[model samples]
Target: MPGYKTHMAGAAAVTGVAVAGIYWLGFYRPNFESMVCLGIFSILGGLFPDVDTDSKGRRFFYGAALLVDIFLIYKQQYRYAAILGFCALLPAIGSHRGWTHSWWAAILIPASVLVAPMVLLGLPWQPFVPYYLATVLGYFSHLILDGKF
Candidate 1:
C-alpha cells in the first residue's frame, strides 16, 4: 500500500487534472483562495482513509478536530463542539481498510462538506459542489493507490 507521501502526491495530481479540466471546460472559474481551499480539502480527503489506523493522517485530523472543537466551545457553540467530538471518534469504530476505505465512504464522508454548512449555517449546498468533488476525487485516488478501487 502507498504511504502518506505517495497518497498525497497521487491526490494532488488527480485534483490538479480535474481542476484544470473543469476550468478548461468553463465549468467553474475558481479564485486563488478557492483553489487553495480545494487543494487542502483534496489533501485531507486523501489522508482521511488512514484515520482508522495509528498513522500520521489520524493524528493530523484528530488534532485539527480538536482545534475546531476548542474554537466551537470558545464561541459557546456547545452543540457543534459535541457533534464534532463525536464524529471525530467514528474512524476508530472500524478496522483499518474497512469501511473508511470503501467506495461509499469515499462519497459519503465528503458529503459532510456540503451537508454541514447547509445544516449548521443555512447556506446553500450549490457553492460547495466543487469542494465535494475535489474531496471525492482525492479519496478515490487513495483507494486507487491502495488497489482497493
Candidate 2:
C-alpha cells in the first residue's frame, strides 16, 4: 500500500486536475474564496482516510476535527458539533486498516463531515457542491493509493 505522503500527493494532483477542469470549462464562478475553500477541503480529504490509524495522521485529523467542533459550538451549532466530534472519534474504535480503509468509510465518512455543517448551519447546498466533490475525490485518491480500491 502507498504511504501517507503518496496518498496525499495523489489526492492533490487529482483535485488540482479536477479543479482546473471545472474552472477552464466554466462550471464554477471561479472566485478566490471558493477556490481556497476547495483547496483546503481537498487537502484535508487527502489526509482524512488515515485518521483511523495510530499515527501522525490521526493526531492532525482529530485535532482539526476538534477545532472545527469547537468552532461549531461557538457558532451555536450544538447538535452538528456533537455529531462531528463523535464521527471524528468513531474511527478510533477500530484497528488500523479496519473500517477506515473500507469502501463504505471512504464515501460516507466524508459525506457526513461535509454535509453536516451545511445542514446545521443553514448554508446553501449549491455553493458547497464543488467543495464536497473535491473532498470526496481526494478521499477516493487516498483509498486507491492505499490499494483499498
Candidate 3:
C-alpha cells in the first residue's frame, strides 16, 4: 500500500487533473484561495481512510480535531464541538479497512462538507459542491492507491 506521502501526491495529482478538466469545460473557475482550500481538503480526505489505524494520518487528524474541538468549546459552540467529538470517534468504531474504506463512505462522508454549513449556518449547499467533489476525488485516489477501487 502507498504511504502517506504517496497518497498525498496521488490526491494532488488527481485533484489537479479534475480541476483542469472542470476549467476546460467552463464549469467553474476557482481563485487561488479556493484552489488552496481544495488541495487541503483533498489531502485530508486522502489521509482519512487510514485514521482507524495507528498511523501518522490518525495522529494528524486527531491532533487537529482536538485543537479544533477545543477552540469550538472555548467559543461556546457546544453543538459543533459535540459533533466534532462524535466524528473524531467514528474511525475507531470499526477495523482499519472497514467502513471508512468503502465507496459509499467516499461519497457520504464528504457530503458533510456540503450539508453541515447548510444546516448550521444556513448557508446554501451549492457553494460547497467543489469542496465536496475535491474531497471525494481525494478519497477515491486513496482507494485506487490501495487497490480497493
Cα lDDT of model 1 by residue, 15-131, tens digit:
989999999999899998999899888988999999999889999999989998989999999999999999998988999999999999999999999999998799999999999
Task: Record all residue pairs in model 2 with backbone atoms less than 3 Å apart, i.e. clashing.
Answer: none
lDDT of 2 by residue, 8-112 (tens): 688888988998897899876667887777777877787777877766667888787789888989999898788787777788798877887777776776675
Query: How close to the true structure is residue 85 of candidate 3, measured as C-alpha lDDT?
Result: 95
* Candidate 3 lDDT by residue in tens digits, 1-149: 78999999999999989998998899989998999999998998898899989888889989998998998999999999999999889988999889999999999999988998997789999999999999999999999999996
Q: Which of 2 and 3 is the better model by TM-score? A: 3
Question: What does the lDDT come to for candidate 2?
Answer: 0.77
Candidate 3: which stretches are off by over 4 Å?
none
What is the lDDT ranking, best to worst?
1, 3, 2
The candidate with the higher lDDT, 2 or 3, is 3
- Model 1 misplaced regions, further than 4 Å: none
Cα-lDDT of candidate 3: 0.92
CA displacement after TM-score superposition, residue 62 of candidate 2 (Å) = 1.2
lDDT: which candidate is best?
A: 1
